[model samples]
Target: MEATSGMPRPELLQVADAVAREKGIDRDEVLGAMEQAIQKAGRSRYGHEHDIRAHIDRKTGEIKLARFIEVTDDIENDFTQMSLEQARIRDENINLGEFLIDPLPPIDFGRIAAQTAKQVIVQKVRDAERERQFEEYKDRTDEVINGVVKRVEFGNVLVDIGRAEAILRREELIPRETVRQGDRVRALILDVRREQRGPQIFLSRTHPTFMAKLFAQEVPEIYDGIIEIKSVARDPGSRAKISVLSSDSSIDPVGACVGMRGSRVQAVVAELQGEKIDIIQWSEDPATFVVNALAPAEVTKVVLDEETNRIEVVVPDDQLSLAIGRRGQNVRLASQLTGWDIDILTEEDESERRQEEARKRAEMFIKALDVDEVIAHLLVAEGFTSIEEVGYVPLAELAEIEGFEEEIAEELRNRARTFLSEEAERLQKRREELKVADDLVEFNGLSLAVVVRLGENDVKTLEDFADLASDELIEYIGDADNMTMDQANDLIMEARRKLGWFEGLEDETDETSEDAVEGEEA
Candidate 1:
């Protein structure tokens, strides 16, 4: 970041240092970023006369700027850069890396010039701060930060952190939790991006760590070195699954986080707008950990696939919905937190899965009406995940099997061919209908082609405009001639509404009424 004044003021140095320390950056880094800002402004304003080279003194609180003429052999014939032999005439001590300060007095710099320099410094400092925040929060990635709700945007949320402000995009936010001005809310910093629009402070209450951080803050063992949080998966405002590790053998991380009367964790739950939190002890053993992560519901069996870090859990029939949570939120959060792809199944589903396996196995051995479970499972283990793959196995190989016959193998192959063809067609049709948009294609003049394409995409009801972010619409029309991205995005937004897209979606209730309902409920 830039120093506020030309000569480093004591207060300016202190502020820069504080910002650097809190953000975990070096003083030189901030200074370098500030100098770059001055250079850019100077180059833009003065072109070849961009002679100002600025530096901030580390030892002494002072800023110094110098103008230098480069040195080479020919000083008279060439003045752009100095020749080494001619430069030696001024000072025998001069070197390539060093430059001499111009002989101008400090009194020569005007008030207007000083003000320009100050403005440049402020801009650079803010830019550097933004870059620093992005770097710090980037590695933190999906973790959550708690802050007071500042305000609402057009479906966006503004949160006030102690040192920074963050924007929680509508899509990144959890669906259920209500936010209001002045409410202290917790959100996951989804992304921290540097853009001309500003440092895009991406935040989300939907992320899994909101609960994890809350527990860490609430639970003493976690705050101390006795316990470490391993992973967290949350559905936000509904339920969450957290895995914790204990460093001290004597202490139970899970129970410790829950507290004596559940008061500690309950406080976190209330702040989450009444979401449920499940704390489980994490394990290095996949089978055990997967089993624990899916608790509250009994896991009958857990089959872990080591290669893919995936797990297929079979829960009792009664606990299926509980294990899955509402709208598959439980498993989704767990999958995200644990970095595991979990396939949860009820006992009935497992039975059906097994039956499906058996059917495929029987298809492989058409000559024989039935095969033992051991043989069927063996066939599955032998890269035969489906009957179609088994058909690819050589008939000579099939004949070598104890139960196989050439005629039966031939029949199996024919059936596999038929099944595969039908399945491929279904998959192709599904993929086509799934909708892959290269974003909304923009056009100059908002012509007929763009309008027609929009209609074909089922976007006629202006509601579809919401799907296109401001940037994408602008990019399309930017190549159309004279339009800017900002102008295009705004035009599309307004045009979509004018085109009646807003009429399709439900009218949003007034904020006052919603707040009253929320207050009464609380």
Candidate 2:
């Protein structure tokens, strides 16, 4: 706000006091802020302008401005200069360097100076009020706030709480709830942060406790502590799970929540876009808790591991798909709520898991040609596992390694030589087709070490993943867990791109983008 020369100094003081009152600040604070601002702007460049002082006496409704100037024996006797005679009159012990006070009229303020003072006073009062609001709300995290969705801009929801506007990002929005202009949306205040602009309000409706809060608001038993929430997990629009308990055992937490005709829950369900909500009983036993977590799955036996605080639920082979949920979401959320590592096991998965783990152990630290688990299995046929034993055996002793006839080893080497020869030709053609310059593409420049690895068929230039036998490829590579089945597909994309075959290769791109993959896991 700007003040003009037309307005009288008393009129300006009235405006400042009005602003301070509206902002819940003392009138003296606004007057002091305006005086400091004018002094800071008009004073010398060195230290602060301590010579200036201002007062707003509430009883008189008058303002006074004064400047403190030092007195000297040979007084300068200027407009702002004071004499030792004047200084010693105020205090008889006053020395030559002692300061004397002189009052300046408020009417002396210039037009621009008055405007600056008004702006400073308004900003200072507003900032102090915002800080006070931030302190009041800082400890109220996860508590509900009634707000109106003010506007949606750039996919962000601007909510108008009574005191301020809160920003709810799209990630925190519920799938079922679409914020529209002027919609009265209730949200939990996730965080309170003080910023220069004001108190930053972080609001969220998708938080799991939103369900508990809604129930607490609706159900008298829950509000009065008759029913207690045990656990809650939500998938926003589609589903929610809440386990509750009764303290007195006479009143049922679930029944009170569901109401006689499911009236209470229906209010919550409707607010959540009719999301399916499962209200279950909580149990102290880990087994029962785990079973309840994996709802609609009907786990037969829950194997609890105390050391890791994990639960292994073995479901029927047919029910395995149900227990894990679509994309394993059901069990994943259950594990998050229970703070347990959940392993959903089927009879077949149990068997395959053990066998695959054992197979990995048999493949560690073997040389390139001896890396195959199938080859190791065949070697075990004649009692051999370590690479140290394989190197000592006769050239004829390779017959002990699976698929290792001296002749097949020779054929394998020959095949690699031929593959490399064809690779050079294929790379040359690809370079031409892709318009690669001589400076860009190289075929004969590979290191001998890399050539040797390729020579042993340890690493092959992938043509495509769908064509390559992944199970067999896993046998050839030793670091089984580090490499995922998806990597196999990605390798094919890399080879295609290197060969300048860039068209329509979406099924796989490369390992760098695995986390940003477009679809659900295989």
Candidate 3:
């Protein structure tokens, strides 16, 4: 019922303070660990079933030991619980949930108990140290850190980063870069994870962000926010490309990063073991950015397909190898830096492809419209590629073609319309033969021709179409309809919604809307 006072053990407090300072942990945490050790020892001396507890005085460092017995109406455990009547014998004012504290004399720890207590304290302190390390480094991902190599095992470098040890794995090291014990190296803190043993700090020397961080360290403009490193792509120990942007109009990002006579970039290259770096200016336009990224190789034309996030780059025949780099490295790095898939082509190749496409279009028109080679060639030359374009285009646009009059334009349009109508009838008949589901036939965003194509591809039912991935649907329909991945996804999603696949989502949305309405009313 009364507070327990024990003999002072100031040496324990001193040890706790020393451990806290050395381990970079709170002194209270060390003291609490000491209390747990004392509690465990007390339970060993006293009955283990008794609720033994220990506390150290914050000021006097006195170790207090006691047994706690709960006062309850029902006494289930005789060792740690008592009936309310028995508890009231000691203190009548004690509440039912209150504990009856019986002060016990501190036991003189035996050699075995002392050893056990020491192990407990050491384990608790180690756990606290690991927790502190995880807390300190978890938020430091993507940051550059400097450390000395402590050891190398199986090509993995163990780095001593002052208070903590980090691992630079073999795969994350720059190729052909060597590191021995005691060598100081800079790496990006790729990740910090908590595991069963302790917190693991992972570092990488070959990460693109490591190069960007190096530039940030070397170039004052970048650190000062005048210039920003937008993206980086690296073939570690070989080559790298970095894109930079300047918020200040007068500051040239590329020139600033290059430093005086290329000093800054050279420093990064040296750190990366002579990895070649191409510092390019970043642009908001993907095409412009791609062109800049593929620098040192002149580009004649760039065609961007935004739907696919791909770009076709055309260069002179002599510059083909240079544009593509050795083994396509240049274009690959350009793709990574600009966030676009890049396909490089020589000027000659592009010209041949254009001519081939034109020839195919002319042949298709000649067969579909029953027109002569001259008429089809004129139509193809005027950029008409399909029967739909020829039929739906303004009569004046077709008549404007050289050597074509209004009468000829009208006649060609009629023939194109007739061909498309007849083709639609034929496809419809095929769709019927394929037993295409009516629901799939009526699905929005799909034309009768596309539906027929889908039926031919065995996507005859709504369920079949819904089961297909967006890319698969695009593949099944072919490029004749110019179907985009996004459109395909939308159609599939609509089909799934109609099949009640999104019922749970709809319920959640309805609940959210109702909650919003109720909140407004309140």
TM-score of each: 0.50, 0.60, 0.93
Q: Identify the superior model by TM-score, candidate 2 or candidate 3.
A: 3
Name the lDDT of candidate 2: 0.67
Q: Candidate 1 — what's its lDDT?
A: 0.67
378-418, model 1: which lDDT tens digit per residue?
Answer: 56555565555665778777656566577866765666676
* Alpha-carbon deviation at 51 in model 2, angstroms: 2.9
Candidate 1 — which residues are off by over 4 angstroms?
1-70, 74-102, 105-118, 121-151, 158-160, 178-183, 186-204, 245-250, 281-288, 299-323, 330-522
The backbone clash count of each candidate, in order, is 12, 0, 0
Q: What lDDT does the true structure give each of the candidates?
A: 0.67, 0.67, 0.92
Mind giving the per-residue lDDT tens digits that candidate 3 earns over 1-522? 554777887898899999999999999999999999999999989878999999899999998889999989888899999988888888889889999999998778999999989999999999999999999999999999999999999999999998899999999999988899999999999999988889999999988889988999999999998999999999999999999999999989999999899999899888999999999989998888999999999999999998878899999999988998999899889889999989988989999999999999989998999889999999888888789999999999999999999999999999999999999899889989999999999888889888988988999889999899999999998964888788889989989998899899989999999999999999
Q: Tell me how far the alpha carbon of residue 287 in candidate 1 is from the true structure, in angstroms, after superposition.
A: 4.3
Task: Decide which is better by TM-score, 1 or 2.
Answer: 2
List RMSD in Å for every model shown: 18.5, 14.5, 3.4
The TM-score obtained by model 3 is 0.93
Task: Please write out the lDDT profile of model 2 over residues 1-522, one tens digit for every residue.
Answer: 112222224764777778776776667666667666655544422234346555555444355556677776564545445677876777787677766655554544567766776677667777766765687779988898888888999788999887667888887788746778999988888899876678988888788888889999989999999899988888888877888888977887778999979999999998777888888778888789889878888877677877557688888799988888887778877886677789989877776875675565456422334345665555545665444354455656665455687875454344434555665676555445544333222333333322233324434333322244655444444341234445544654455566666644544565436856644454
Displacement of residue 117 (Cα, Å) in model 3 is 0.4
User: Residue 423's C-alpha lDDT in candidate 2?
Assistant: 55
